[model samples]
Target: MKKMNIKKILVGTAAGAVMLGSMAIPVLAAKPANDVLVKNWFVYNRSSDFAKLWDDNKATVLDNGGVGFTFNNVGATTWYTAYLKAHYNGDLTGKTITANVSVTEDNATFVTRGDGSTSTVGIVIKSAEGNWGVNDYWWPTNRQLLSALGTDVDIIASTSDSNRANWINICGLPATDATIHSGPDCVGGTYPAESPYDGFTNALKNVKEVGLSFGGSGYARGVALTGGTASFQLNSFTVAE
Candidate 1:
């Protein structure tokens, strides 16, 4: 793996001081009121007000240019999802997003004792058709990393107006599973509807937010992780072109 040089930029705000990292350049002045790309990132731990987790010390900035979190006793009814939205008001048509993501189980209990179908970690891109009424989402399929020792993958998504969105797996080894196979080769199905936004490309055309998410529906089906820890990391997320 190549070494990543991530810079941390701290700015003062009415709420206090905020830390922004991995930006192209550091802004020494006061923070802007609307920094869609860097600010307003919150962790949703099975609740609508997941943003509160930021202040609770649940999310932390890793030393290696990434964000990390630990979940304990998380049930099927609840999961973790984190996102950062762009502050711009224009459409994201013809744009692409890329990132290096990794997820690992600190212990083997979940793999050895569980059915191996109960966990998932992935990248998600969300977009709204118009002003922000209904939204659509795109992400990688669970089979892409279900049975692997951990996740270390590079994912790319390109957007278009129609169902022309594309998700490519640049490199990395992902585990495969037999069940939950209903979508593209490595990409997952689009949410709400699958007809027009069958692939990730169409969903990306109007992207409003993007981020990483961990958790699966397998727990609801009786598969549980009684012991072990899982960590999800995003080295960086940037506009591809």
Candidate 2:
């Protein structure tokens, strides 16, 4: 009887370990098999924000010809979504991001984790702290903050600027057993209870990373390139306060 009890305890412990491991794994957002997976940049996505992934990131040079990269994020990943991100770290309070760039796509897809419009394409920012900066899933109000690109001003694909008026601050997602933002298009959804406009200002003051968004509205949360090819060409990008 003693031996039997020990055996049962061991088995139960093993089973519990397996269950915990399974619960830890998250769904594939833009992950493709190694044979087809091509990533030019690396970012840490915890569990919920998988819609934002890109195959390449580039920087320009002037002295000896610039380093130019013309990429099509469409069909580049498993979900047929792709983008080019130019990373930056700084304070963007009362500032505007201007870029000389163009995104040419035969098609586009826009999806939001919650209900909001899932819109905007121009400048994507992450805070140096909070969800924008943390890598752990349990972090507070963690999410990628977007600038008012399409709704406030349609400057994408041109040499214009991305405004930060009413930028989208995603709080909850659809698959996370949370309430959606209440809109389908970018800039159309109201702010979630957890994420308010005040949070946006805090994030901007401590901006960690910023990227040039080529996919309008659904810049990073959905199948932006569902049917056709999506290409992003960047010449110059700057932030003005």
Candidate 3:
């Protein structure tokens, strides 16, 4: 219920598509602009604690692998747009985007170079200019991106081992129905019904808008690196606000 310290909402990827209309693009310089829809993104591949949280906060891993962090909000302070939001189902209106993730340590061979070695974590959101389906929220969904602000709500991490199970997600409760909160069990114990997104807790909360197309279950098993190749890479992305 309280443990959201995920460096407070993440970001990266070309200043997140272009830091919101760049200073109101000349003071509403014409009006008719409010397109912001940087959908849900919770990527955490190559989760080895991400180079000690980017060298204890030296933050700066660009070239395509986006992984920067800095904030101030409103009056002063600049540098927006984060990463990981890939999961679209089509028709992303207007356009100003960034979303893609990948991971492959020992799926068997592991040889994904370039942006191929795969291993990028995430959390990026932007959508204000042209607004076309806004509402993005996340909270510990699974294991990587662990913080967010607006839009319905999102959280994951409890696939349920029962009781004090780790975590689990799929929110948006209220109208369209969406509720899957199985766990308090970390000290307690007893809250299992096989819930990862199933066991029916409100099935995906019926997420309204955003790319839509994410796939990755929980895999636990490390320790077997002979040659090299501990994959997990999800290039940066953005569309500021």
For each candidate in the order shown, give its overall lDDT on alpha carbons: 0.39, 0.32, 0.26
Q: What is the TM-score of each candidate against the true structure?
A: 0.49, 0.42, 0.23
TM-score of 3: 0.23
Cα RMSD to the true fold for all candidates: 11.2, 20.3, 16.6
Name the top lDDT candidate. 1
Model 2 spans > 4 angstroms off: 1-83, 103-120, 129-164, 171-195, 214-217, 222-230
Clashes of 2: 16
* lDDT tens readout by residue for model 2, 20-98: 1112111112222221111222222111334444343233221211112222233323332223343345556655454
Candidate 1 off by > 4 Å: 1-39, 47-58, 75-90, 108-117, 129-135, 140-143, 146-152, 160-205, 215-225
Model 2, position 188, has a per-residue lDDT of 40
TM match of model 1 to true structure:
0.49
What's the lDDT for candidate 2?
Answer: 0.32
Q: Across residues 1-241, which tens digit of lDDT does each residue of candidate 1 receive?
A: 8554322211221222123322221112334222433444445443323423332233454332344444433355433333322223334456555655554554523321123445554555556534331125555443234336344366555453332423321111111211222334312322233233332334444556566544443211111234665544444555533
Supply candidate 2's per-residue lDDT for 152: 15
What are the clashing pairs of model 1? 165-201, 165-202
Clashes of each: 2, 16, 45
Q: How does candidate 2 fare on TM-score?
A: 0.42
